[model samples]
Target: MTGTDTPEWPRCGHTDSGERCRGRTVAAYPACLAHLDGTERTAYLASLTPGADLDHRGTPFTQSLLDELLAPLREPGSGRVRVGEAAFDEVRFTGDAELEGIDFGGFCSFASAVFDGGLYVQDACVGGDLRLSAAQVAGDAWFDDTEVKADAWFFKARIEGALRFCVRRIGGSAMFKGMMCGDAYFSGARMAGVTSFSEAVVDGEAAFDGVHFEQGADFTKTRIAGRACFDGARFLVNSARFDGADIGGDMPFTGACFEAEASFEETAIGGDLSFSGAQLAAGVDFRRAVFRRTARIGPLICPGRVDLSGAVFEAAVTLEAAAREVRCRQTRWARTAALRLRYARVDLSDAVLEFPVTVVGRSRPFVSPEGGVMAEPGLTGSRVRVTSVKGVDAAYLVLADVDLTGCLFVGTVHLDQLRLEGRCLLASPPPGPRWIRRRTLAEEQHWRAIRYGGGWTPAPSGVETYGPGVLAPVYRQLRKALEDGRNEPGAADFYYGEMEMRRHDAAVSRGERTLLRLYWVLSGYGLRAVRALTWLVLAMTATVLAMMLWGLPQAAPDPVSAGTADGRRITLTTTKPEPVNPEGSYAKRLSSARLEKSMRVVANSVIFRASGQDLTTTGTYMEMTARLIEPALLALAVLAVRSRVKR
Candidate 1:
């Protein structure tokens, strides 16, 4: 038989285009030499020698031959297949290529190898480097539960179906750079070495859920057309980088733990990027990253710095951290983007927030994009809680629109020179008052608390707190910001705060400092008109009482002795009206008249006017003091009222 027949004979089962081979088989064989059972098959089977350069290009592999080829690798530490240059290019498998549990002893290359079916390498051990670069896989590439002792490279490889490496342990570097494949699964995989997927393109979803990386991982320039997940993945040490990655779908990192530095710099995300319940122990960099959708990172434990400089959040960006160590510096939010930091302890010392920063509370009007009347935004819409904001730089820091009603500011903040679209609200909401007739004990207590103080104390001293004079700058800036926003009432409040701070600062001149304190004590630094009026009334009343107690001087008829020329004088006594008893009712009426005149004199002195009654000061010093103080009180009251009105 020449292995070529048209009669009733078995032909080679292997064909590139599914055309039956014309070559006949040997005795009792089902296929020709190319498939099996011929001189060529025998030579090919015998060529599978140990410790040799296995060149299997343009050849076909049967299950039995593959078994025999890997039989040596199956022995535990006994035999090695050291193919110095593994050439399996364009090789085909007649059946499923099962290389499971086979240990590769040296560098292996299957570049451009074609798998007609799935490639199963479950629990396989690569003793040295393994390269499947540019290999074309028709079915799933299963490397689950395998161990790669040396570098594992799949650069530029194309897998038409799913590629799984779940639960596999890679000891050395695992690189899939520039790989274009279907769904890529690496869930529960443990990589003790560097894992790189730079410039890779995945057509289907890419999952690395619960994977553990002992070293750094790089996914720079990767593009995922489907959903990408790293949920519960742990980066134990070194850096985990995802720079310049483009994710078309959701990229959730829920419950992920990063023990070292983690970076997503310059990445572009199309869907929601979530990190809820994630634990970040080291520094995280998201500089220049672009989020097309919302980026929610809440209820996380981040003890390290989170650099978000130059990052663009197209939608809302919500972050809630348990630790205040997270810093948001120079992060950019789009005009439509809403930033919420609920129940978080964070630092926005140098953060820049764009305009239209509205929250849920009081209603403020805003025109819709369709050019129609829309309900005003609310103040308490979303809450952003922070431990401190030391020196924040905002594009438009409209405190009114930047609803901080839900925020608890424990640190001193600087609000300087930022554009204001509306009012800036910083004061607490006013409590309702009770009418005098309907007030109860509880109502009275509430009123007392409001009138006296709320029992608030200064925040603890830390980096967020500035020393004595340092707060003056903050108040100054805040006043300027309020004035710029055209909130004169709010500006006046902050101006008083600024002046009060300067009064306490040692840097101020002694005279100015003393004057400020006096102003505050007398009339609340010209801010309390009621207090100024009360002091004026009290001073006038005291002067009136004193003048009443000490009677005014009555100019008696000037010495009534008729004086002659200087040499000799003759006395002519003037006739006196009938004398009255001093203790009699008439005498008492005269004394009352004197007292009334004294009261008028006191009132005239206080008003800075001459008394109509001819009354002289019985207590000259007291009168002079009254004259000086009454005018001062009047001036203070006028100034206080003017301030209240101007504000």
Candidate 2:
């Protein structure tokens, strides 16, 4: 075993079955790259110290060993070399070497090998598939400016240091399943085929900015502990899915275009999601993506659909200044936050927006932006529940078939300035009873009065006219009139009733009518006329009674004389005097006529004694005369008195 005696060291050839010698020199280490089996190679490499070197002091190495190590990479005709067999402390492949571009055929193992210096593969191409699964590098691993013409599989490979692929291009598919890297940069890399990183964990930031994917791209279940940016990257063919990928920092897809479908379903992004200028040709499905912080998709244009169903934003989901048609079906936005849709055209038909969806400020909870006009005919069947809805100034907004049943609006629901072109039913449909009944006479009158005065004019100062009780029906009729251009009798009837009612009201106000016209008409006028006539009759009767009393006898009878004798004798005398007519001519005429009409004379005699007049009457005669003149004179006196009183 002495050095001078040259103890028999292991030969460079197979010392046992399935082994080869692969080291810079003999006596350096027995477990070199070429002397072990696949399993042994991995185990040996894992046992090395970090930053360990492969070449120790060289001894007398056999010529055969040098030739095996220094042989040029075999041509395409020759089969590929299975390079790494035994584990080494470190495996260093340096110098200006040109490996075969297409010869490698089987699995290449470099698992857990630490390269202390840079492993440069600049401008070199690997024609056959390269497998570096579970390989770890301590120093800088340069795949920069390189091309893998075949499918490159690097599953579970761990690069402890910076891994740069600054301008590398992969012609075929690049699979990096469960790959862990410290800080990886694929700044301008182009993957002509599918590039997948399913479940790969990156401890540091991974930048794929400005990278182009000709086929599809997938990062499903990938955990990026640092920022993972696909900013300005283009996915030309199929989808770029990031479903279940956890991004610990800001994941920006700014200026990226998904030519096909793009998905971020169930992906948990810890920081902001800035897709500010991304263009999505196909559908962008973000169902169930949890944004732990702010999520911004502002200024993005998706020609196809964008589904954000079941996506949760912990902070604000700002879509300010975006022009895409956002489909947010059943999205849950958090409190004290906003889902700003400022200056964006949102098609939320059939969307289920959760409560407290703020549009502008944090306090004001709504979906429409402040000072922003919503495009009409947009949100036909959407259900949005918010504390308030404001700042809508769009004309012809069609909310016809929308179901906003759960919306609870507080404060004033102002439609004062809103120009509703069509029949816009509010979330709460108008109460039915108001519109069910036909217009009453009073209602008709009101409508007519208003129309005559110019419909719906503001009242004069200090006057406010309340709206009609049946506003729904009124509005409906107006809408029909405007739309159909047909005149109905109902309108005219209403106008008539309105005028009549107004006139009656005015009469009542002026104290001109004791009763309303309707009441007066219902009761017959006979009672009023009878009341007036009764008063006149009573007055005339009083005048007649007064005249009778004034003309009645005021003096007592002149005398009745009674003479009493010793033997009870009595005498009575009566004196009668003036003529009936005062006028002398009428008296003469009456006397002459009385004489001409002379009547009969009668004589009477009394046997009993007593008064002088009685004794005279026993031997006297009495004359009777007809006297129409006296009666006429009496009637004239009465008539004269009556005429004087009348005057």
Candidate 3:
């Protein structure tokens, strides 16, 4: 359908006739829709393309003269401008006018040009490169839904007002380096190749919602005074960098991905930052970046490290469902909300975690059997909650002055030195699982004797302080028990017996012995034996003195004697003095008379001190005295007393 074949469209008074028209009137008097008489049409078209002049000097560039172009289209009518089948390859727009919906049919270049008013190319299609490099737009520019067939270069362009490129797709590279826009919107735009906005400055919001970068993209050093949202964007190729960019508002990158390294190093974000569900094939570095509000990188996966070293989050930094091996070196979080790193494998080696921060992990079943390993020392001035860490080799693993009151390790927990003020449970073998039974003391001793050749040190002080000292004693007892057995028991039985003996020894050491006969005997008569020996010696000395005094005549004799008192009665006493010896003599003379009489008494005392054989002998003697001699003496003393009473 050609313009000429149609019927005559309504024409306004601004229409021109004859050769002055740029081309044949398309069955319409007013060749361009902007020349319509309505004020609304004029105003709307004025917003589309500013600085439009119909004539230059005395020559007409279009159908309407320059004076006629100045007149505004009146209200109650739609204003439109159509550039159909036109080759404005190098056209320069210099005046303030309107050219809405103007189509540039082929390659277009307004390079190094200036436009005093707004330029609207809404729904326009450029067949080739659209070079607006170094162009100056004094009013708001609208390129909404515009398609650039070839590479579009707007490098060093200055737009005094807002620039809109909403829903536009560029088939080739879109370079906007050093371009200054009052506000920019390229929402839902698809760039087939690289899109470079390096060093561009947007005074207002720059919205790139649902934008697709088919290849690489770079926004390095771009400054945006307003929000820079690339929500739901995808970078298909590598080398996607927004490094050193400064954003005045929130930079939400929800559901974004970078196939290669995503570098945001040194970027400053004035508002909240979000990168939910973002995936980076390589490392993502936000090192030394500053976020003015909450920055979230949740549910993201980076196959390589995610470095946030020296990055300052003015608010909380949340990292949920993070990938393995995240490096959060020297990150400073200003808000009270802890930087959550749940469900992540974090390598905070050499990291300085400040106070009011919490490093936590997900509460899930043990996914890794080996558990988490620390490659280096981790310093935590803040609290770290690691719940359900299964299969840890050490529960106090290299912890230094860390307050672990709330930390939980529900599986096999290991430690180096854990000074826990609160309670901590050691990981035990799970119930219903195959458990390796603990070795018995006998088994341990046998093993030790065989393996180490019966050499061992005493248990450490800490162990002795905390528990009963039984290891050595148990070991000895196990050796003795095994030696006494004719045949060695099986390993299991030996181990069981050894353990029982160990327990027994522990009890004995704790003074739980059933028979204390040896102790009782040693304590009871230990001093009494010495005292009895001393008394026996004293008695023997007294007896000796008595015998000596009786055997020997007294040195001092009594003064009065029986026959010496009166001498006058001596003659009568001599006749009655017959000796006892005379009776024996008379009996002997009669016949060989025989007579005999005998009386005997013996006293014995013995004391002995010895060990082993000699001790046995002394013990036997003491027992005999206790069981027989002592009792017999008591009976004898009783009988003697009874006989004396009878007498």
Candidate 4:
């Protein structure tokens, strides 16, 4: 009821719409019921009984009156205060409200409840839940510091400012689902039960730094328009999921620890996703996650596996961590930027990596059935890059099943220590004999025995079946790679391998093969200069031994003139044995000098050297054969030396 402006009793001095209220005061009160003082607040509150239907809506109560009104709710076994649809429209609370353990019978709403101070509701046991849906608070909401027993529901609740929660024990599930709010600080808060924010849109920064989820944290389909940080947060129990979450800004998960399964499947991140230093005890599935920008996942410690299959990244994505196993099958690393792995130990068994990708560091050993523990990692079907790879661990790389049919290599393709257990298919099928050599029936049976048996078998084919069939192409590529790197020694090794394969080719004629094998056995395919020199020494010794076997040739004794009875003189050849002299004799001395000259001539001729001495010609086929043999050996030796020096 409106009172006169100048009434005998004091009217409400509270201003509304820039004007004072015209309502009269209560009995013995200075102001109206809407604006009562603290001294008269108790008298007004005492008038109501325990079961009284209080309808103090729109009334401005002092801090003392509000405390006394809610005093009964703080006690145990106190009946519910039936404030039927009590409205607290635009109510300004001045002091900290300790409304713990408050029971409301009906839908009690403080829609526009403005708190100038903080709201402390520790261990609040409410029979009817405090559905403060769409409630507005001015100060921080402290539902945590004290163990809140209420199922904290903040559906569509808007805080005009910021809020923080402590490590409070929640009795039931706390849902901030679909709540539109400002900055939220959830540092060190442990929600002991189920927590959900499905479809909730946070307009300001949501910092869950160091927060622990004892159960599950479901943020499925949630949208965060600002920065969302979960740094150092721990998910101890159920799955920590952010499936289909759309993050508008950066989401830094640095140092976060997850004990259970964590999934970010189908999540769309507009900014960078940083998981640096994150520790995972269980597996994390990021399948189909779309990163609009870069993702830096490094310095991480994950003992469990990580599945990132089908993930797509628009920008660069680098993995610089150590984990037990990483599966990225069919993951699209980037659209344009490089996907570089530094110090990562990944098992890219069936992965499809985009071009311009590089890997550097040691990985798990690649085991082969035929060849025992091959300490290498395999990139089975990934595309080879020309300029991306640098300083990779070539010693432990496995490219057995890799196909380099169309790959163009610009730099060194180090395959010296590569494991090629599978068929080393380098190029496509060309127009040539499918099998390296003709496999006879006996050869085939022998190969089958080698395949099934434990030990080696003797094959009918001159060359072993697995000797050079698939290794030819591999040797070619290896030679090219080593040559590009300017490693001449390594290149020469592969070159020898290539030559050996050609020499063993069944298409090669027997004559050519005989020549090639002869050279190979004698001098290491003409690449070993020492072998040629050793053969030369043996040839010289053999020549000297043959000379010793046959007596030294003395120039045909000068035709001797015998005294003829007639005037004509006749030449006589002496075939008589001369007596041997113990010391010096003219015939013996002449024989020794001739032997020395003949030995020197034979030695020089065998080594393809010119000798000044000329021996008397003995017209015999043996002499001609000896001359041809020495020249041929000399030519082979020269070729061997040339090949080694040029190589």
Candidate 5:
């Protein structure tokens, strides 16, 4: 009923638009201002004053009505709309609305309000919270240069036009939960309070460039249909999250800085992800983040960890980070991925590679893995190294120009298929009495010290270093890999390692171990030609000495007759002399003639030939043994030389 003719003392039910009215009736009038007659409405309008507390909940206003309602609030000097606590909940503005330059003194709410035209509230300062929860704007909405002392909420608000916001500072929490907008631009905003856009949907490009959040900023599950750019944005306080956000186009975080942890966990980007010129002081997580296109996530300074664990990339990606750590555990790549890093301990455990992937080190400005060059200012050239590749199928994995001095190859699959290019540094044995002469794995050294030195070098914490039995296969596989790569000379070291492991392994048969030990003692596991040749020389020397001392007789055996014929009466007896040891001092036994004879016998014995001169039993046995053992040592020397020089 109209307030001018109403007789009842009850409140007005709703406005002309059928929205239930919550505004109080004026004086004795039973209806609100909208329901009052022209005379009564004019009387009610006169009662309103500037900066007065306003509650127009569920009120529907046309453009003229909105203008009339806002006309009184204009500040006397500044002519800007100034108001105290205001509630516009469920209010509808039928046409374009301009509420810009408004100074709010206390709490203001426009929750569930509908704006058929652009809603402009630029340069507004709110003393208390400003809420626009579930508000719908058919046109653009602007909140640029706005300052809210208390919490500001736009949760579930749907803005049809560009949602432009540049908050000067937000004192309390800011929420954009489940809001849908187009062309979101929040650039150059400084937010002092924590902000969240969780589940917010942006239909067009969303740019947060140069926005600084002193507190946390969350974009969790905020799907952006167009490009998402956070270039130069700073998150200095709490962790900035983008976890589960699905970005349709390119997402650029170029020149951005996140002091706290920045997460992109499970985020699906349909285009490129670039983080060039950014510095993530705390860790940056890309765990399970799938990029349908290339991800250029480098040329950045990450003092903290960068994890790409379980992330999937559709195309080539190059990461050049000065990071503390980078983990690619179970990360899958459809194409190539190049990691040019410095001072980062990369772990690629269980990573799946459909194409080739490279982990390279760079201390200087060099071409990136994707064949592009990055800005090289202040490049430290701190070596980028791989610490572990456990459980990685290395068939398509490559290490180029990286420091692998501490890379652990335990539990790696298809390890023999790994491709090595450029100067891939590996650990070598420490300086010892004997030259190690070859590069080896650090794990091998660690395990060897434990097995042989009775716990000399400590194993990794909480895990036992593999014993010889386990290391033997690793060496064998690597040797095969190098050999398959046509690096036989390089394989020699691994071959030696394999033999050493086998000799120490209890899994090996005792006879094999014994033979291996003998081989090692005599020939350095058939890889040291000097050891084999030296043993060969010693055997020949012993043979010569034995022959000179006991094999030669004092005089040449002479024929003597002693038999007499007993039956035929015409037989002559004959006896043959045998060789005897020379009856003289040891010096006499080393006579030049005897030495010449013994040397000749020993030289021929090296060829497995018997000397024509008869020798004593001990000398004959010595010659036979020398022929067998010395020639074997000589063959070992030959094999060692071949192993060193083979193609």
Candidate 6:
């Protein structure tokens, strides 16, 4: 029954959009060219010519049949197959398909194509855009050494095996939006326009070694489940954005270069994120980025601002970028960290540092992860300067070899616990017109300008401003911190600042304020030995002049002779004439005898001893007055001197 009935062409089962095929069939085989087999498929392909347009939609092909179709198009001299526009939509490849060294003269569409085996288009040239939208590739998809003149779209394409683009260059953008792939290797691929992988998912490792992206590279919202390596990759002139990228493993861009901005805003890295030896010529922003493991963000050369504001680190991190400015504001570090920066102004305001964080200005370049030095020429400076530590928890903060002269520590918490090493400096107030004051805080100057108008510039709008009530404790804590390090002299400036703040504090009692003011005026709060000595010398000179002018008598007094009558057992008292003012203003009062007597009286008065000399009626009162005030000035001078020399 089967032989006579002849199977009836099997009713050509292919369908599209719920419509049965209207495809032509020939020679009792009753199938289209794509479905033909054996001698018949070969016979039809033998008639195909080079550079001819072909339509093979929904074709199901074996490797041999596919090769046969491209055979006639091969160029004779160099074996370069050149074809016109081709459509392989919904085509199913049964085995590995090699289209290497082929040139497509027009657009190439493999839309919704399925490759059961590897798809190789290596060394191929596509004159127009290459579209593989919604294609499914089970084995490796090779576009290596290929050149696409127009855009390359892999939208929603899935590759179970590796996707490679080794040495492939693209003229237009490479769009991989929502693509789901396995391991990807793009080593040495150069993309002329933007290369976007937005919302794509990578299940295995990604290696983009030495790739050059001429415009930009965007990985926004990409979900990478494996480690991504971009060692030596270059983003030439545009920004490289990794915003909202979720990296499951380590992402190392070692030796990579970003000529423009590189942003990782809100990115989450489950493993270490490294940029060892990377050169970021423009700014790099990592705001709100989270690192679950250790991050090695340094040994990179970043000349622009490197911002890590609002970033949260769950483990230790070492950052050694030579950035101009580094902002760690509101960054939360859960474990011990180190920042070895060069020529950067670090801002750690509101940083939640749970463990100790050591920051230092490195004199030498940082060592890269591979044990190489990250040295760059022409850096202006190699010091890490801390500009603002306001709102920082300074309990476990350590600073070494840093410039803090202009640093603002107004809102720092637990400041007394801060540890500073290697020449930390605080700024001093500028010289006053009539006097020189000790070092003071920057916030104090602002407050003084507001209150007393010393011409200090006002803080910018929304900038934090501090008053004496806020500054006094700051000075006290800083003073204590320096003192704990056995830097007594270093703490002197802070102590003076504390007293000045106290004198200006409205919260202090009026009497205490007056006393502090007096302390400041008299001897610079007992810190200035020169001021006290100056006062001491002036007081001594005035006392000697007054004693010579009116305090001493005209001549030496004589003791009474009556005491000799009872020389054997008599208790005798010496009696002198009543003291009176010298009456001669013409010339008689000026004498050598009076000068000698005045010297003795003044000397004795200074030491609280009696000067045995005959005096005028006004002289006795003057001697008592001189004894009281002169000694206090001398004592102040001595105290000032001792305060400076003490440990």
lDDT for position 113 in model 4: 53
Segments in model 4 whose C-alpha atoms lie over 4 Å from true places: 1-146, 150-167, 176-182, 270-278, 335-344, 348-356, 362-471, 492-647
Give all candidate RMSDs, comma-separated: 13.0, 26.9, 23.3, 13.3, 5.2, 5.3
Stronger candidate by TM-score (4 vs 5): 5
For candidate 2, what is the lDDT?
A: 0.47
Writing each residue's lDDT as its tens digit, candidate 4 over 290-354 gives 88865555444455656677778777666543444565655665443333332223433333434
Which tens-of-lDDT digit does each residue in 275-333 have in candidate 5? 77676767889999998875676576677788999999987888777777889999999
lDDT, residue 518, candidate 4: 86
For all candidates in order, the CA lDDT equals 0.62, 0.47, 0.50, 0.55, 0.82, 0.79
**Which ranking of candidates, highest lDDT first?**
5, 6, 1, 4, 3, 2
Which 10-residue window of candidate 6 scores lowest in summed lDDT?
1-10
C-alpha TM-score for every candidate: 0.62, 0.45, 0.47, 0.54, 0.87, 0.87
lDDT by residue for model 3 over 157-273, one digit each (tens)? 889998887637789889999999899988788899788999999999998878888887899999999898888888887567888999998887776767778888889988766
Reference-based TM-score, model 2:
0.45
TM-score of 6: 0.87
lDDT of predicted model 1:
0.62
Tens digits of per-residue lDDT for model 6, 1-647: 11123222333344668854433343355666665667877776666677876666555778877777889888788888888987776667888877878888987888778899988887888888888889999999988688888888899998988898774788898998899888888899889988998999989888888999999899899888888888899999899999999988888888898989999999988876677778777889999999887566657677788899999999888876787889999999999999888888899989998999999888887777577777664357746789889899999999999988657888799999889899765555656775365666668766766766655545546667787888999999998998898877778788888988888889999999998987777788888877777876677676666677787755455555445446577765677556556667725654676667777787787776878666665677777776786676667778777766668
Deviation in angstroms for 36 in model 2?
A: 13
lDDT (Cα) of model 5? 0.82
lDDT of 2 by residue, 1-647 (tens): 11123223333344446533323233334544455457664554555432222232112223233234324333335443223222222233332222332222232334333344444444444544555666666555667555666677777777777777764677788888898877888898888878999998888898999999999889999998889888899999788989999988888887687788888899988887666656666667778888887556544445455567677777655554332345555566662344443223343323333333433311121223233332322123222222112222212122322222222111112222212222222222123632212233223323434555433223334322333333333334333432332333323323322333444443345443444343223211111222223433343333223212221112222454445455676555565432122223433433432322221111111112211221112112211110222222233344433322431
TM-score of 4: 0.54
Better of 2 and 3 by TM-score: 3
Cα error, candidate 5, residue 129 (Å): 2.0
lDDT-wise, the better of 1 and 5 is 5
Ten residues in sequence with the least summed lDDT for candidate 4: 381-390
